[model samples]
Target: MQMNGMNIKPVTVILLVLLLVGFYYYYYYYYYLSQYRFNVPPCPTSCSTSEPKDRVPDVIPTDYVFHLKTPDHLQYSQPSIVKGRTDVVAVTPWLAPIVWEGTFNPVLLDSIYKQKKINIAVTVFAVGKYIMFLKNFLETAEKHFFVSFNVHIYVFTDRPKEVPKVNMAPGRQLTVRSVPSSNRWQEISARRMELIQKLIEEQLRKHSDYIFCLDVDSQFHSRWGTESLGGLVAVIHPGYYLDDRGKFPYERRPESRAYVAHGEGDFYYCGGAFGGLLQEVFLLANTCRSNFEEDAKNGIEAAWQEESHLNRYMWINKPSKVLSPEYLWQDFKPRNPEVKTIRFSGVIKNYAAIRPNV
Candidate 1:
């Protein structure tokens, strides 16, 4: 074909038109469809015009009975079984069919035996300055807990070399895992969850149990390990909303698998300090990946960081135990008389103290 003394191939023109059309369709499906896909679910009619259905039964049945037992009475005391085998029992029923068990023995039955070794994992950005606070917190935690309870601190950081070299207690251990740095704290937190999942899969030995994911900036007080083992435990966020009516960092959209819309219930949870059997951590890690992936496609960074995702997961999957705020005391407010110790005291020098400037 000839156009203005220049020859144009008919096939080329057709190909260009088709390419443009394909590009248009791709955007429509990825952008437009994504919006519709993530739209929030409608509020319940009871919440507005009618009463919501009774989620719990008003009358108790004779056959329905609740029994509380000590950790010794439990079926399994290990985190998980080997990946493919089913013979292993879970430390808690919530973490079914334990795949593998960690070496950290439970100190549940006797206070004297309660000093068993425990492994704690932390995800940090450039928390170099905060290292002292963490060390102080751990030191305090050791003094309050059973003297025999050993702690192996696993620090997942972006700048491994920059992490402050601190002296740990005799039973305390520290290991750092490296990650890519990000300016957005929320993005960093979300990616840290992913990094934790990877470490559990690769670095963590099969014999390890009781994995804890903690914020690098937070400190651990005396009440850190008083609770029983083999179950999921979370500290109350001093920032937690008393009622669902109040606006919370909790993710509320239905399109988001992490949505928490029930205004009358307690679904939101703080992620500052959380620990459970190894199998449970694996499950939680898997859930975090799904929620984070969904949020990423929508251009929404991890809502309120990874805590929001954790809150959503805990809501649907009730933890074995719900701990009071004493576990992870954020440094935001003055300490209460009853509070034993503060975790991430905001008084820390600066981000440079613990984290790298980069």
Candidate 2:
């Protein structure tokens, strides 16, 4: 075992060498050997699949959108016109329901939506260091968001290589689209509407029935299932839903296209999460993208970027269903008495570190 001052074991030396050799081959197989077998090309800095030739109209029948003509009794609770949540205002002045827990029966809603066999498409952006949040966002989604539905997740990110490989359920799939990186966070945030509009126009319109655009740095904590489905859905921002319209942080400048005249706005909807029937969301995204571009032409930016534009758009075109603060609660905020559950929430993040610019 010891020769002079040096202790040595032939069996130990042999085992250590074998371990290093095993690791080398393991890495080689996955890193190089696998690629060689498949004849794969190197990924580009910004890569994208070629555009499809055929494009289709973005439309869905309005009739029977909520109800089935010939109904099947799925057997849930009795009708609750007067026996629901009394603490919170359940419906907006425009008659759009503000969805909170206990307001709707999930079983009944899921059953109806299941019958349609509709496809739900979700788009999330993870450019720059925001790619770090994709794993939890996607993993939590598989657990809570539309668990049994036909779902497609379109991830738009500059760092496609960093996109996490989440094993989705049978009816769910993920698509990654590479976008050029940006230096300004405002540019990345504002350009989301443009990218979503193009996504719908180019690909989603053909097979997708609905689409939800969500922020990447968020996770689903509860059911954001078929119950939230509608023609146009907007989540009431958790930060300012309880505040007055004057303090609501709308774009106040008349020069900006996103400007909302004083006393001429509804609920402050979040830009982080919004969606609807394919055509409805297409129209919303298109309008916001155009207005944002027009404002750029005039050399003015809104106070809150795309969020301001979204508020202005929602003023003229009311959201068909408004989700409460429960839908998009902030991780930093304490749970309010009215919020029975947090469905989908933005995770607390250091903006300076993750964002390209703060």
Candidate 3:
């Protein structure tokens, strides 16, 4: 209708209102209902709550003492047997690198290739303590990567039964290897060295081509598939310090071989989530012994924790590929623009309610 010098359309007004209503509904459905949000509780300052006291004891004694040998003494070997044929083999080696040069050759490609499978191995202690986080980790991993390709999760847990049964993809498999529990979670990485060594010797000798060692306390939030694979990949540590290396917290000791050798490096990487060619990891795992022992002597069980040792090894022996910080991230801080994805998010939870006192 024409009124005065302007034209008014009743149909246009009605159409605009409908469009606004439709947009609101669409936003609400996708933003809130479709996505899964985890509500992380705040951590307490003091150790009074169920939180485990950070008792940095003078030194914890161990029955077993490890000695580092020269490169000549160390063996450069190959996989003893090849059980299954796979496009890419993944493994997390703590110790004992079975020779596998004959089984698979380390190929450096100019561009990324299609990955048929990804294998992840985690060294777990009391499953009951971090069961919730482990469950979430497995579920998130499957959602982000396993759905698209064949993925196998191998967990070396002290208590396998405590691990819940979650749905996995068609080619997905979860293998649980029994381990011993430790008084401190930090010590698990060190104490389980023997267990991991044995497992690699027996099971992972020639099973996987690529391997990732992950902490059970982390969860997956982004796409972490074959694209992240290479000769050696280390994620930027969420707790890395840009200033003086001394200011950097965690189990960093300058006198230690890992830190002392690489005194002037750009950044320190976290061992929570790391991947590499099976041969490279096996070599490092078998050779990097001095740093691990030095950290143990100072009453440091896991020595810079595991990541510290890994950083030192990488410093001395630079890997072919160095991944960005997005690979394995922690929930201690907010996200950064440079971060493409986070392999693990440490959701704060009630520790006392979950884990009992040792």
Candidate 4:
């Protein structure tokens, strides 16, 4: 321990050993440990923050993790189990609320979430000539969709250059993430779950409280605020909410991952719009994406692409909130008396004209 020194005490050697150990740790922390902890690969110049550029290896397993939290000072009507919407079923068999016009108090719910500074992420796809719908989709959104709240719209399209610029509200933003153009609209629909799963794992879990995956071909006609937020949310397919489950357009093929046996599905949920707590939608997107790919490998495409898979998944994992057909009425359909308001509805499209392939 003394080396060439004339006199070296045991304490001196011990102190020197301690100092060496400290230096070793300092070097490891600066050169290796810290890098491992904090360094992320430099993002390619081709893909910036607005675009989803990376896939996470350690994607958190989506599990049940949601509990409603409404802060104090939320003044609303007292609940009466018997006084709710009696015309249309207001609650699911499992007790999840069917969101009709009168079932939720928008003012009180918005105030509760506003106080918490909730951020809602909306994902919409407008590829090919579908981009034309982006204009009214966003403009109407500013007017009726989560107004006065922090709304971030993520529009995925192959044609980023053509993304329309509707003036955003103070707390709202529009992001364009380039996606490949698909010849088949069904392929595009299936790919949505893949991209959505990636988006949630890459960013939404940290930055967003909730997410709404909507159809770009649709427009907002009435308020779509906090009343629709929940752990797992599904809007009833306007076409089939009144129809029996036996007639639902679910994938009946046993070979397909989306197969729903007769009399099993609770409701046929529209693929056009469904969302919830970031984690909940993450589960839906991840599961649907996996199932869709599995089915593709076996040469079995569901009847309605992702929509069929969504109904299958929702059947097994019931939605916590079921929005009535009012949430997504088709403009082509005659308005039902039960649809108090068309919060969002799909505009009739000339599919042959806009789609890449008819």
How far in Å is the alpha carbon of 73 misplaced in model 1? Answer: 19
Q: Model 4: which residue pairs collide?
A: none
Please count the clashing residue pairs in each candidate, in the order shown.
27, 0, 14, 0
What does candidate 4's lDDT look like per residue over 203-296, in tens digits? Answer: 7866787899999999999899988888789999999988888898889998888888897878889999999877667767877888888888
Off by over 4 Å in 2: 1-58, 64-66, 69-71
- Model 1 C-alpha lDDT per residue in residues 1-358, reported as the tens digit of each score: 8989999999989999999999999999776555322222232432221211212111211221122234444454555544432332233344422212222233443332342333444333334344445555555545653345566667655557756566667766667766666554556667756776676666663435566766555554443443434356554566553444455677666656466675733535667667665555655666677667867787665457678777766665557765545555556577675444453332334554333433
Best by lDDT: 2
Worst ten in a row by lDDT for model 1: 56-65
For each candidate, what is the lDDT?
0.53, 0.84, 0.53, 0.83
Q: How far is candidate 1 from the true structure (C-alpha RMSD, Å)?
A: 16.9
TM of each candidate vs. truth: 0.60, 0.83, 0.60, 0.80
lDDT of 3 at 78: 44
Model 4 misplaced stretches (Cα beyond 4 Å): 1-79
Best by TM-score: 2
Q: For model 2, how does the per-residue alpha-carbon lDDT over 1-358 read when each residue is reduced to its tens digit?
A: 7768898899988898999999999998776555322221232332111111222344454343745532465567788676879999989998999899999888877777788888999999999999999999999999999999999999999988888888999999999999999999999999999899889988986678899999989999999998788888999999998899888999998777788878889989999999988767776777677778888887888999989988887887788999999889999999999999999999998888887666
lDDT of 3: 0.53
lDDT of 4: 0.83
